[model samples]
Target: MPSVEILSRIQFAFTIAFHYIYPPLSIGLGLCLVIMEGMYLRTGIKMYEDITRFWIKIFALIFGIGVATGIVMEFEFGTNWAVYSRYVGDIFGSALAAEGIFAFALESGFLGILLFGWNRVSKGVHFFSTIMVAMGSIFSALWIVIANSWQQTPTGYIIEGEGLEARAIITDFWEMVFNPSSVDRFSHVIIGSFLAGSFLVMSVAAWYIVKKRFVEPAKAMFKVGLCVATVAALAQLFTGHRSAHYVSEYQPAKLAAMEGHYDSSAVAAMYIVGWVDAKSGKTTGIKIPGGLSFLTHGSFNAPVTGLNAFPGTERPSAVNFVFQTYHIMISIGMFLIALTLTACFLLWKKKLFSQKWLMTIFIWAVLLPQIANQAGWYAAEVGRQPWVVYGLLRTSDALSKEVKAEQVVFSLVLFSLVYTLLLVLFLYLLNKKIVHGPEMTPNEEDDSDEFSKRNIKQLQA
Candidate 1:
């Protein structure tokens, strides 16, 4: 019971991490489905139609999981954080309701058509449904990002009460939606989602290539996945820079913790890699000279805030955790960029699918973006620390007082068991899909003998 706070936090984090895996995937797959179907419509390629069908199954699977796990998060608010829920109810209600009405409705309405209407509906109509579903997924992300960004940099709200009764009231809904960090963070997240989605596609395709299953289809799928991955990984670099600067302006302490800046300096160096020593309050590692200062303030000599600027209590509780996770995310992102570029070059050379070693690396590399995405979220949330709504609400004060430590501990255990089962099931099913590979039509099956010969030669070579 003494560890109730920790238990509750773990419970929420565990459920959220599991839930998070799917929505972003569904979002990415939603777009991928759009692209596949669009290509089929444009080129009248039967192969594209086959690929569309294949990925549609994967997308639907993740979408269902996302919904099932996501419901837990919704119920969690009232159960674990009633005080926080009541306070942000008005603001969250608006965003979530809009998502339900505008996003979910659009997605649900068209999902049926998208999954089932290939033969029944006109191609044009089905294409329209795919587009709608993609748009809905994006709009859903938009609202959720807006709500979270508001918490990061609260605006357009006023506190209407005191003590336990205090609540936020909207002043300008648009201002709330477009809060200070919203745009930058939103861009970062969607691209990260896309990056994860592309990784998933690439990993599966990579598996197929290495295992000598679904050769031509896997090659085609890998091409689309690589195209998406390369573009997204590159775009993230620029978007990440913009988001970092936004953090510098709005949440200096969080940024300070992320970069392991211990003391204010005009020529702050960004650690390319480092470890933080909490006892000594120092970070030691090889770092680019003046890189952090330049990125944060647009000049090498520009001053950057350090943890010392804020009281110790105001800073994130887990500096090492924040610092390590933030840097690990960056390291993975950079590695992915390099990997994608190299893959692009190999693709141009017409040797992408032939490279057994590269394909092997890619099969495992798909999990990198998921780790990076979760790390980014952990850094953002933990670095915000102490505060649940930035300057307005402390996290401790936001807890539901009526809930006891024993209850929270029990619920955490229950959630852990449930989530563990879900993870096992997801892995089993996903593995089955990958091993099964895409089913080729009779004509395509006949056509693959030549394709198989081509791959056989590559394997021999």
Candidate 2:
């Protein structure tokens, strides 16, 4: 039997993966701009001013793509998931509208000032614009998270009617905003963005060092990346822990699936790495005793529900895989934190530049966190299986009734091809910009000439 559920999932996954490529960058870069502008204001550093300008150009490009792709996802909710939209429309519409009115407007209005008003605006005004841009990103995340959290821990909504005609209405806006799962998820997402941004900074800095270009500017960027990555990574651990606890409490079925538990137990073992046997309802390869219990309940022997407790229709089939993937993502995130902090320490000891291996590792480290972010998102969304609106609406019921599988399949293929082309173009242009480097100041060029002469003499000796 061909299932529309499969098509719905495929379309949703494609759109989300494409749209997601940009938001973390925007969120992280927004914060980076704030830090850069603040440094310029505090120290009167001309280099900080120049670096901000350089990064702002890249930010503008990425931000535009993010906005465009994000719009598609919104439309997709109505187009492909019409039933889902109708079911939770009242609740989601308000949050999205607020995002546009409160966050998008502020971001667009001030982004121009941040990017192009350097000469037109006063220093204080410029700094204020940067702050506003950062706030705008945060504000945007707030509303979006509100809508998503509603799915995870539905509140402030009352269902009316029956079966296919049932619809959810917003009864309380504040309650929706402050839903039990909202804060933890929002915090975790924002921190993940910060981690992404910090890694971007470090990766670029590593590239600069490898090429022996813009040493001072690169060092400054590295320092900012180090601080951000360190703090965000640590914060992610805490927030993720909190989010996991919330999931265990509010969505225990998901927790059980994530850990591949088949029977309820006082102490459940977590799989650090393994494959799940769906037929047998068990995990294989490896396991960590009581780790799942400790993670969810903060105790070694706390009772945790298992998949067997839930009906067949209620269980997510890939629970163990999702759980293991999530654990791997977190492990990579922790490693990034440690790596960035260690690089910072080495830099402090004047040894970072001398260690090509560490710098090489740092150059590629950003990829790990990016993958982790995507995997984390996949786990969160997919592990909530069978239901699109938690207990309120099943995903199969929420798919568009009129939309044919072939129509969706065609669009999916087209979108994939177009996005792949755009991705290639983006990477090429980005590489070109990085290779060109920033426009050099006159004094910087003079200093570079002298430094080159000294280097040549040392090489001759």
Candidate 3:
């Protein structure tokens, strides 16, 4: 039989990795829907309306998958991490409740209006629904980050008693919301969402450009995506910098592990690229000297703490892998921002679309931001070593006591197989929708007219 620790880690990793595949798309698509609807409103263009409707179909599909996978994660909290739940149930329960009440309800509610009511509502009203859907996504992210930030910084909670009877309770709601890491982390993540959505739009547009199809629709989508990508990319950089500084101050060990520095020193050099050797607690490969200090403290001579400062038991090895990976992710984000901005400038100067090479690069650039978003989340969650609830309980102590290693392994394998099938099905469906494109007849206006007639009859009653 596999060890209990191995089984638990496997289950957690499988569930989380599956859960992640959907939310970023949902969050990003929410903004894209808003932009599409707004463009239709401004220009009274039927093609824009058609494109919006087409993408919304895909968004709805993804949103449903996101909700389904997300629900599974909650159940695993009770099943796989029962002990952890019992310990921080009060804190997480509140944050989760808020997510349901504030984010999920708003999202699902307006989603009905945005999707089905498209035909039944007026232009202005339909536009408002799209805005609400976007707001809902942002609200959803806020509560989730609040919960995760608590895990990282762990504020406004008190631990009472000891052993199996121990519990962590919330003392202040606002304090929890405005936790030290919450704001920067939230901004960085939300901007990443924007980047994801913008690039997806750009990708589809690029496909159209290559095929020389849907010229007007593709151009409009590309322009909107370019603007969003540029802004989000810039904001992400700034927020990432701020978050790194926050990590330096509040979670010095994580900061140290990320840089792979074994000893504390002033003017620490950041390794822009490297392979970390866990046994020696050092990194090898390419290095950028003095960059770490400058990035963390905005000074070349600022003292940066190292891994040796922490107790042997407290140091996390695999967590450092996540840290290093996050830097690579950020570098990818920076490169995309520069490349997209340059493309945008060229497009504005009427030189971009004509260049086949540039168009080819833009077509394939969608994957970069997606990688960065996933990597950033990995860094945040993995960096909080030992503690599942940050100072309240260690992960080793928070696993299910009643569960057997064999049972957990069985379930882990089952989950992986099932999730793999579901992923394949989802991808197939998504590709079908993309390849079919928007239908020409029975457009958004026609749908709206039919809805108005039905509504008038109801009003007469």
lDDT scores of the candidates, listed in order: 0.86, 0.82, 0.79
Candidate 1 vs. true structure, TM-score:
0.96
Q: Is candidate 1 or candidate 2 better by lDDT?
A: 1
TM-score of each: 0.96, 0.95, 0.92
Ten-residue stretch with the least lDDT total in model 3 = 443-452
lDDT of 2 by residue, 237-283 (tens): 89988998999999988888777777855578877667778888877
Task: Flag clash pairs in model 3.
Answer: 270-292
lDDT of 3 by residue, 178-252 (tens): 889999989888888888888888888877777776654666678878888888888877898899988988888
Q: Write the per-residue lDDT of candidate 1 for residues 262-360, one digit (tens) a residue.
A: 885546789988999978888999998788988877788877889888888788979999999999899999999999999999999998888999999
Candidate closest to the true structure, highest TM-score: 1
Predicted structure with the largest lDDT when compared to the true one: 1
Instruction: Give the clash count for model 1.
Output: 0
Clashing pairs in 1: none
Error at 222, model 3, angstroms: 1.3
Model 1 lDDT-worst window of ten: 447-456
